[model samples]
Target: MSTGIPNVSPNLNLETKDLKTAPGVSLNENQSTVLRSILDLFAGKPSLPKLALWRDDATFTDPITVAQGRDRYAAQWYGLQQAFSEIERLHHEVTDAGNPILMDLKTRYVIKGINKEQTINSVVAVHLDSEGKVQKVEDKWDGKLPEGSIQNVSSLLDFARPMWWINYYIAWAFWIWSFAWETKKKMTADITAQAFRHLNAVTVPKLVSVPKNEEEDAKKGN
Candidate 1:
């Protein structure tokens, strides 16, 4: 039965011959094989054999992740298969003159259960060691890497949330207690003043003076 969906892996070739490379520089046989594997990975075809091209300690960096070890790096490529139903390699230009081989990739991605397709352009840089094993890879989408310390500041602020919350609770408790104390003090003073005025108006008490000896004794006791 034709499902009306196209198969993804038809031709993943690196020997395109017309690719723009550095002047007087051509990719070797091993590099071509590795580049083909990379294309396969980008086409959402992740295999154990293709992942074997990377060293054990190889690192990979992309916009969302900075992964260490070949196995860790391969996980992202594997996840790509689960995300998109099909991936079509639209265009690629390779440069192999330097330590870091670069690929400018344009791809069409078809997400599962979605009617629309997305076109994405990316730059992949792979650094190969003497044994032709990948040492590091950096993938930048739309050829842009995130720059600035704002992200670092954001992480710090997130970590400091607990501390901020504790301080806020302490200050709030003090503010409420202080208001309670103030209200109590004002109520007591006002009530005492009103009671004294009402009692004085009701009764005319005899004026009595304390003896000088008793007053001196009270002052000495105080």
Candidate 2:
């Protein structure tokens, strides 16, 4: 019988990582095998044989990317190796014990060619089809909604870096990100408010009228 999913490329990395669970957590026999296999992909060690574990149309989505099919999901994971030099699994824990397993992972990342590091927490929700094949994997970074339309492969690297409001970057990243965003937002709002105020300023005539010599003045100003 053919699995709907394509056979994983033999060239794909089958390396595995040690699954480090959070304190006070004990996994059942099934959860141990399943979670270990899945978490290894994010630990900078992807498993090629595990591709058969997912269904053909299985989706993997985080905040910035939406991918359909097991192949695309594999792309997101495999891209991790290219995007990052090091991924150290700090700890991970299963938050939900239901059909769609919710596992929260905290890991430290070092971008390739840069020694600067960032610690990120991602919550991976694994949904299983009726036959126990993977149906969908929703990565909610700190429990945020899977909301975004960027389908670029490059944006897949964002998964390895800092993103969204689960804040606390390597100090500088957080400071700059916060300051820049607030400044830009305030500046835009100020500009808009000033524009409206200028339009209704009392220094002008109370009545709104069609421009008379504006065209001639515009040409002269230019």
Candidate 3:
């Protein structure tokens, strides 16, 4: 079946670090297997399939918009395969912060149909269901253009051109708003935690019982 997506060359190089399961992140045997399979797929293992890692209702979100369903998510990868001639995983790190696992990766790839190669640094926050399938993947990447005098918008525009400028601006606005909101929430939580720590440290001594000698002295005076 032709997906209307361009086929990439098979000689893509993907260098990744050893996958480490995060501590304190509770994952069953099935979940662990799923996560390992996903890492292996991205690590350029030809035997591992990518589509099997995601659930039927999986959702993928990037800077542009959110794509729902496993097919839509798979389409996103198809787009990547079409766009990049050579993809390399510059760095990869996985951290488990309790529930969901966080994967941070830096990638550099040569854009197909364009003469210049580009680099993208991205962080993917993955959520898994009980059965170990990927339920949601939230990806945030630095989409800044590469540093060079040569500008090639024609090739990209030929592929996927924006219908309207309004949609582009709206996507940027939503991204900025979401980033600010998350930053504000994190700061507020940190401030609240600091206040509680300070209050406990200062007030805890007063709540403690008086010293034994002082109490006895006061009792004698009474």
Q: In terms of lDDT, which candidate is strongest?
A: 1
Pairs that clash in candidate 1: none
Deviation from truth (RMSD, Å), model 2? 19.6
TM-score of decoy 1: 0.55
Instruction: State residue 67's C-alpha deviation in candidate 2, in Å.
Output: 1.4
- Model 3 RMSD vs true structure: 26.2
What are the lDDT figures for the candidates, one per model? Answer: 0.55, 0.53, 0.46
Supply every candidate's count of residue pairs whose N, Cα or C atoms clash at under 3 angstroms: 0, 0, 0
Q: What TM-score, to 2 decimals, does candidate 2 have?
A: 0.55
lDDT of prediction 1: 0.55
Per residue, candidate 1 scores C-alpha lDDT tens digits across 1-222 of: 111113322223332334455566688666766777777777776555456677779877654445566545665565565456778888888855477988888888765544346676789898988777779888776785444322222244357657744564443333223223332334244444333222221111111111134344234221
Question: What's the C-alpha lDDT at position 85 in model 2?
Answer: 79
Off by over 4 Å in 1: 1-24, 148-222
* Candidate closer to the true structure by lDDT (higher is better), 1 or 2: 1
By how many angstroms RMSD does model 1 differ from the true structure? Answer: 33.2
Error of 3 at 79 (Å): 2.4
Answer with 2 or 3, whichever has the higher lDDT.
2
Per-model RMSD to reference: 33.2, 19.6, 26.2
